[model samples]
Target: MSSIIKELVSDPHSSEIISLAVGMPDPFLYPLDVFQRILENMPATNPSDFGYIATEGYLPLRRTIAHMLSSNGIETTPERTLILSGAQLLVLPTEAGLNLEILEDYLIRYRPKLFYTVSTYNNPTGQVLTEQERRELLLLARRHRLVIVEDDPYSQLYYEEKPPLPIKSMDSFEGVVYIGTFSKTLIPGLRVGFLTGHSALIHRLALEKQYVDLHSNNFSQWLINFYLEQGYFEDHLNFIRSEYKKRRDSLVKAIRRYLENNVHFNVPGGGFYLWCKLKGTITSGRLLQEATKCGVFFVPGQAFNARPTEENEFRLCFASQPEPVLVEGVKRLAKALEILQKSKTPRKISESFLKPIV
Candidate 1:
């Protein structure tokens, strides 16, 4: 689990603590109506609903996902989509803005078989790769015989214009594997996510999964199938987009009002995080300590760095909290910064400590 998520889950509701740590979706947006409808329509007691599905996942859901990917410009068949349970690992190019020059050099030196990225509205940074960068990555992957894994779970949560098309949508998508999820769209409890790629690869993955969990929950799959088929997913997406945008705006406003001079950050066009760089000497670790004292919590930015870390950066998430709570959290963060700034005193050099150099 991510350090941010661990912090959120452990002691989630302390008396006065306001957490802007995790990217968890707002529980207030749960689509009770759609799930209620699906439950009402489901047979009261059906053995098939409890039976094990194919290792690849329920066929209907796979088919739905295939069609959805096709619309997104990733031409795939149901046989090509591998439904997975989770994902992990981290390493990235050194150059900022996802520099392809560094990426190609790393690819050549490492000769890695697979490359992975969050391409759209990246976690923590909220930076979306430009189309030109995506194209360059695809070309490099093809030239070097490397597989690209695109984990995109936030594409649908944009507050501004939609982000660039997925790399899997490119004509060179044959070497690209795309992963997406309904966990954010519906609810995380649903545990529904899928991977799209060549049928041959999907087949092998399914074979491996069969030995693991047998299959994902069949009952949940049926509910998702019903939700998608009945067109509830689209309505739900629209609803949350509006609500989350409000929360994003609220956090941004509060940060500007309270921490603007002390910190610097770009407003995200979409997704759950606000990455902030401190303008002072306060390290994120120290800030987190003081913020905890001020009744707020956020992850230090060093947690996300692939190399040696500067201590001045941290991430704040606006999606999990209500608008009022989001604002309060920022105020608490500001309070923490003020406290830290005031508490620091410059060390004075004593004449007794200074020895004359001969």
Candidate 2:
């Protein structure tokens, strides 16, 4: 999928080809000037700024994260938040660590074990776990002495209504670990993200990070802090939200008007993807091949699932393409589907019957 996206990007005529393929905010929406200004203002501080800082991340960035989370109702101390490269790294190891911590906590509490998660809009799906579902899962986790790892990267890109609070906010038992990233909301190349959890678990993870990168990019952290402190980050996020929502609307409208009923998908509230399930006589692989012929591409859903199945599905990212391009891409996809449907033939199978021994 990455190679396909790369090929699309490398093609001189790629702009004419609509790409619902790659995940990332449109370049037009980036806060380039803000970032540039921050970079331009960087002072030649101690050699350590160019060198390694703390493994957990620079103190200012960690404090900023704590303040940001606190404003959203998550009371995270700097000690309980460890900066990482991005949310993916923050989530994977933290999830593994949470599993161990939960087991140990459960053994001490003499309780059963449980783990609840949103694994759909999960990465490529773009679906957020609903509020009621989140509450119910938290209740179950609490009852069973389990931990909830709410890996929310796309929650802030909603099309309608405000985003829900992090599940960590509802953790009376301190069983929720929330991971967030600037890669999606801010700039991808910055590689800045953080996680919130109990101090003990975070401290252990910080030690683990010490062996990894020693710390996240101090210059990047300083740049982010500078941007946020200057009050440009929120404005930047607002711009991104507006642009992404517009693009998402365009993709949905185009799909509804041009595509047939053979394709079905959920319109996510926020995030970068549309999880499409093909119906009747079409496979994702064939659809992809046809789309490629038309110079369009998307990721097949099997890559996101732990256990691959015969399900015919693919993910479409709208945030990476403009409205006109997305519409054109969807049109290409609709045309491909029509072609595939026309080429399919029905097969009849007869069951052999043995007459009763007469």
Candidate 3:
């Protein structure tokens, strides 16, 4: 992902390169005009809020987050939450959803210090664990006294019906830590996020945070809080859902129109990706190279897996482009697949791409 971003950034030919690899909100959709109005109307000097505040976060913002979480069925308090920049997540393997049998064995064998999950509208895969699975995961953590970290950044971006409440909502044993951010819904530049967990855990995390960056940006927090309080989130969220769903449908239609016989994928109800697999001998690695040459890009499944894999799976994000561009990208991908299928000596990735970012 870093190399792809670097290539796009450094290369003079980047304008022609279509990237479907990164999970990002489109700049075209950012509410810059609304934000300008909000900023223009703000007070120039509010010393208390502008200066260094509590390590936890702005009180009104934390209170707002708590209220929002409660509306979604997750009981929280400002005392149980902490302001954060973002989170560090490690991806694990899955099909349409998590398999508890394999998860149980892995937990017993590895005895990991912490287990992390995206749970809803998962990145790269667009998989959402069912409510029963969420409950079972909580049960597993309770049984083993394991710490389950739930980082749900895409739950609110669903395209259709809402996904099940996060595992943290059903966490009866205080074993789950839930993370939320506005990067997807609002804007990434705000750099505002929060973590909800047991008060004791949040206290320790807050102390550790004081040494790192002290606290999250107070101005950004205030901006988001004001935005939320003014009832603009739901309006912006509704627009995002409508626009992204159109692009998602366009990408799906294009793929089906061009690669139906050679590839297969699940059309996610919500989220930004279509997890795909080629049916023939064309490997994801070879397709990736050919696709790059064809001026289209995507993330191979190897990057998301925990172990070395030879699967032909790949991820394509539709949110970063418009309907026409998304269709054109699929056409380019189809051409790349055609090139790979015709090549006698198909190349493969010599090194792994599963290395962590951030």
Candidate 4:
């Protein structure tokens, strides 16, 4: 996880590299005006502002987040929402996002209490589950009496078509637990995330979190609340989507022109990644080594798989860099592919190849 993000600013090759490894918001696009306004309006030397609030979080922020989620189709209230300094762990490891049948099979085999997924613009794959798939998944969860955890941080960052309503929205049995974050749409430095679902579940989580830390930073929550109130959140979202769409298109065109038929890929409707598969015999480990040498880096698909590694597959993100940088990154990746294909022996796999990107 850290490996992918580390490449963003801390990579040794930052000056020369055109890295498309991390799926992060472009810092240049942050709404500094909104921040300034929020700061300017802050109550100077106020005592209550810095005081610790409930583990459940500040009421206004939770209510606002609940309203936003409701408008997007996920129904919830502040009471059911739990604010967290970090996201709740959903530890079901799978090769890919859960399919209805796969989920049911796992439930039967493992008698697992919950199913977890990133349904829209999925992390490394950039794959969005279809409406029908979402419906069936919910149905299966109901039938199995299982909990479904929907980790949806990227649904709002769409490129072309709006993604299907989250499985949480479609859940009729109240079996879905929805988790979201401001890290992707907003800046990552603002570490705020929330969970919504059964009030009992939230209460239990809140109780556990109380021991971890009294609560998240009240100032950060208030800052985001002010950003939302100013009506800049929506505007900022629209602006980033347009900019990201351009970068997405650039990546698609660059891959077509450079990698040619050496790889197979799907253009995502929304999200930061371009999931790709190698057409040749070279493994993703070899490709990464070669690509790194060419001043580019990518997360191999094997890192996301729960079973054996799919060394022929890899993910390239187009969100962090601008269009020109994305184009250059793709070109470097192509050069790496050429070198990998031409090499007769496999290169030594690096330990970093096993690190998951999202």
Tens-digit lDDT string for candidate 1 (223-311): 78767877777778888889989998998899899888888899888888888999988877778777777888787787676664787
Candidate 1 Cα misplacement greater than 4 A, ranges: 1-7, 10-15, 43-46, 86-112, 345-358
TM-scores of the models, in the order given: 0.85, 0.84, 0.88, 0.89
Residue 47 error, candidate 1, Å: 3.6
Compute the lDDT of residue 274 as modeled in candidate 3: 88
| Alpha-carbon local distance difference test for all models | 0.76, 0.73, 0.81, 0.81
lDDT of 4 by residue, 270-328 (tens): 98889999998898878888887798877788888888766799888888888888888
Angstrom error at residue 323, model 1? 0.8
Tens digits of per-residue lDDT for model 2 on 94-154? Answer: 4634677755664564333436454325666666666677788888887767877777777
The backbone clash count of each candidate, in order, is: 0, 4, 0, 0
User: Comparing 2 and 4 by TM-score, which wins?
Assistant: 4
Summed over model 2, clashes come to 4
- Which lDDT value does model 4 have at 108? 66
Model 3: ten consecutive residues of lowest lDDT: 349-358
* Alpha-carbon shift of residue 23 in model 4 (angstroms): 1.7
